[model samples]
Target chain A: MKKMLLFVVLSMTIFMAACGSNDAEGSSEATETEDGKQIVTFWHAMGGASQEALDKIVASYNESQDEVEVRAEFQGTYDEALTKFHSVAGTDSAPTMIQVFEIGTMSMVNSGHIEPIQKFIDEDGYDMGHLEENIVNYYKIDDQFYSMPFNSSTPVMFYNKDAFEEAGLDPENPPQTFEEVEAASKAIVESNPEMKGFALQAYGWLFEQLLANQGALLLNEDNGRSGVATEIGFTEEQGKSIFEWVERMNTDGTFANYGTNGDNMLAGFLAEDVSMFLQSSANSRDLIDNAPFEVGVAFLPHPENVEREGVVIGGASLWMSEGKEEAEQKAAWDFMKYLQSPEIQAQWHTDTGYFAINPAAYEEELAVEMHEENPQLKVTVEQLQATNPSYATQGAVMDMIPEERKIIETALESVFNGGDVDTTYQTAIEQLNAAIETANKARGE
Target chain B: MTNMTAVITQEDQALFVRTKRKQRYKQFIKGILFLLPSIALFSVFLFYPLLRTIYLSFFLTDASGATTVFVGWDNFVTLFQSTIFQQSIKSTFLFVLYTVPLTIVISLFLAIIANEKLKGIGFFRTIFSSTMGISVAAASVFWLYLFHPTIGFLNIIMDTFGLEKVGWLTDPSWALIAVAVTTIWMNIGFTFLILLGGLQSIDKYLYESADVDGAGYFYKLRRITIPMLSPTLFFVVTVTIINAFQTFGQVDILTQGGPQNATNLMVYSIYREAFTNYQFGSASAQAIILFIIILLMTIIQFKLGERKVHYQ
Candidate 1:
């Protein structure tokens, strides 16, 4: 009986400890610190090389100002950071600001969790005109700015110039169409049967980019800009083309099946196991620096018949939480404006391969020198500028996009591993529609 | 005189009944006092959340987990209809089948070997039980590197042996097995340690009597070691089954329920639905079902397994 009593007391302590209020311990960290400076907590999801560059930038911002000290925290990946944000929103532990991916725009708005940046812009009389138009277009909904565009990128084809030459193809001009890419893949395989021709990382973002390149919308309601999206807007022809392209590559044994792992696809590229892949332009710096062979960056490919309409903007934007103190908001606002300055944007553009939202940063000495040294980075910017502003190219905005991406990712994987393209594509669409409806019902729509 | 005597006896009976009732009430209050803290803790952490989960199952929740609308049994109906959830259920059972038996058999084998009275046997015991010290996240990360599609140790070995490279994490056919292998390796340490402890606690005289009867080593092991170890084996099996059913870390780190949702275990599915999809209603429904299944499994195990367990 005594042992049982002791056990009960011990377990009670453990349970109470587990259920203790977390905000009390967590909230005290980011509110303020020594020296009477309001600390603006900024939660971001930039990992790896980008985290290093971002930390340097945040540190410089702190040194530049005396009143507001900006604290930047790396909060895992985009999905993980968003989940954490939702759990902590409306709590004392919530950050003063957060960097959310482009797809999270609608969800963030509907969540009623964020203070739109437009109010801050208008109050400060800030200039939104100087920012990149295509990047801004994705974030601007209902003629209002929900988030300040920070780091932006687009899909670009990465090819091995050495392999292209080995295949007796033009090293300077990479393949510009699916048919041409298939032919090139065959040539590269003929040159050396061991090296695979292409690797598409069963990723959904690249699929969206390809769909937009063919001028197809991914969601209804004009890519969910007019109102809530109801279903997939892409026609069978538009969606099936991508699946068929992957299937053809699979049949030819030229597609390296990396299956939704970007890291492996990248390693395959660096190891010269696969010749070409489509990834975010944000990877350009890492690829150029690490690859043993010369890396060629090209515009995203469309089908043989459709005109190339360009790619959607990828990457995250700065969103201020709704209920932060006025002082913290001002501090975060200052940092946001500081980030868009030519000098900082130039540094960010060179350090990471993301676009400088301030197009004037292109003329900054740092950016100019980097662009001259590696013109592949300039191709990324050119693709963004070349993009025709349309519902398709502006990208889809839906809370369900993250879920939808998984559905499409699974379909892509099935095709990569010899699943029939037509049936797989059909099932994917049905699943996507069902998921959207479920999301809508959850929202009480 | 007679009336006075009768009244006094009735009064004594009344006093006796009143005292008995008062004593019983005081004891009940004392018992409740002793149990108060435990009751409060259980209600706060376990019971409240369980009730809330059941309540939330009958409604639709938004991103903030507020119930936006009452959906009745729609969430559960949809879950049963979802092929993804169906696959998740099948994969979870398959995962259990793969990991639990293998973990027990391998750990039992290692325990018996390490139980030998030999030189430097402590080193072998430590090595066999080393994985208990490693957290699931760390172990999964380590195995993720080993099973990486590119720059993986396993693939490197395959390449060296002049064999075809396998997509250990990427292929649907291999991903569940890969995760199971990691789980088995991580679980071996605890199971082996417990079984080893049980083996050591067995009476030396049992083996001595067997030896006097000219019993062989294997015979002594079968009769003495296994039967004596049955109670510990039962406990180990129960815990391992529960742990296997609740596996989330390995699948999250290694696969994220990809390669056609092949590794989407039940807990991971609940997580994806609630946290990822922000459908707390559906997630809660899944959770309630999981709770029922585990409850039934444990009860069934106790009923049947306890009969065979030889507790000494």
Candidate 2:
């Protein structure tokens, strides 16, 4: 009897331990109102100053309203946050809103977990002209706004003014064309024996930017949207030209490839070891504060043969979570509008070095005043204004784009790591097309 | 009257036995009461999830997490046919190959050194064991930064020595080796402790007998030390192989299976498919294969161990 009792106690202890873990896993799924306020939670990956800015916005909204209170929560890195958001979405305890990266836009749009913000816009009668056309159109799915643009940034050239002067190059006038950039960088390298000529983001964003400027479409059939058949069109003549340029740069050691991890680029740039970098304009504020030397910001260099179109937005947007009540949706709508107000837009842009998507915000006297005080903000605006309605050339969109991106990135890595560019790119094109086909099928395209 | 009294006494004895049985039954019921919570937990958590994964493996789940078709073995067939999946398997085996032997050998060496009656042995043991407390993700991140080709600490040190920068994690050729080195470093302690325990368990008489036989150090090591350490070595190798095959954190955090999929392990591929691509069915099929591989490897290890281990 005592032995049986002991076995029972042991089993019970194991059961309780198991139960404890389950409770931890399942506890966050609870959906209950706190303090009689219809509390809605939001999960986001934005950290540092960007996150702090978002939190302040949320706090302001909470203080302004008594009915619907949004509880903002940080969920870690972008990928981790997206994973957790997807996991908890359908449960009774899912967040009412989530900040999803641009790569996840298509998936979220198709998942039906996100409510169309266009409905809120119509109901609230918000001015359509308040939003920048390119920005609004980018987030739309079949003429419905599925998300709100929050942190839109474009890639631009960041030069160290001190490095430029040290190399006896004009510190004020940065390179305006690819040919000039190459020549100037080579000169800089020769002039200063210690520093590197150029380095870009590890993912080949610089290459893409160059291609975009040269009227090269990354994907066929209007970038795989609008019911057009798709193709991996980046391996065409235009792409080859860019690839050849990279090869020449690498071979000549004019441009040193950073580490496979992006740290090499970031660390080199921050330490003033590299003369020029092609990084997101969102890094403007951080660069200014952290850079050891005076920084010079400029528009991304265009190819001499073609007009400079513009850069694709690099950051995330606020997506409205699905399965929420009308009241919660209304609250979200109000918060989004509050975020898009001229004052908030100006502040966000000033603080984070992100471009304000609201034209009204840009035209605001306060924004102009701020831009006058710091001319670096004008560079991103100028870049955005230079953009054309070339959707195919702008940015490619696809279902399961992140997967296709991984394949292409792998191909890039191979080529950059001394593998044959043509063969590797050809292989990547084939693999990417297969992934695209599968994704399109999944999307019921 | 005398017969009736004898029958009554028997009946009383039977009644007493029945009362004792009831008391025992009550105790048994009390035991079951204690077990009820645990049984409820196991049924709800482990059993339910295992059954659910099996069920979900046969279905095509949509982005909305809705399942559609009952395509039994279709996912597995597709997985087997894909060159990428096959390559992942090959790479996973390679990772295990590099990590398992190196980790076991290194750890055993450390264990022997630690077992020696040398000064500061306790400090070395503590330092080695302390690494197990560090999170794999954190350690991988640190290693990734250290292996960075341009700004990495390794590169800086190499530059100081006038040596060219080595692509520790970037170059395809050296990526797996770099990851293996990191894994071996991180995991050596646990294996060391296990081997140390086995070493301590050896009968001192055997070594004394070897001394009597005038056996040299190498002879004693080959015959007594290794032979006696077989049981622990077998256990460590089996567990190490299992872990090496399941390597994902290092690849994911350090290299992200990059420089052209040089470090793409099976588990990482499975995770990418399941979580990133949301290909739950295919990922499950991969996981099922992994389970089988591990099971077979462990069984083979045990079989081999039975022959090699010197029980005496």
Q: How well does chain A score by TM in each candidate?
A: 0.95, 0.89
| A172-270: candidate 2 lDDT, tens digit per residue | 999887678787778878887667777654464456566677767667776655554466655467666655555656665667566356656767788
Superposition error at A168 for model 2 (Å):
3.4
Q: Is the docking of candidate 2 incorrect, acceptable, medium or high quality?
A: acceptable
Candidate 2 TM-score versus the reference: 0.87
How much is the lDDT of residue B249 in candidate 2?
Answer: 87
> Model 2, residue A403: what's the lDDT?
73
Q: Which regions of candidate 1 are displaced past 4 Å? A: A1-30, B1-27
Q: List candidate 2 segments past 4 Å from native.
A: A1-37, A63-69, A204-211, A233-235, A363-370, A443-445, B1-60, B68-83, B118-120
TM-score of every prediction relative to native: 0.94, 0.87
Please name the candidate that would achieve the greatest TM-score relative to the true structure. Answer: 1
Global CA lDDT of candidate 1, please? 0.91
**Fnat of each candidate:** 0.68, 0.56
Worst 10 contiguous positions by lDDT, candidate 2 chain B: B60-69
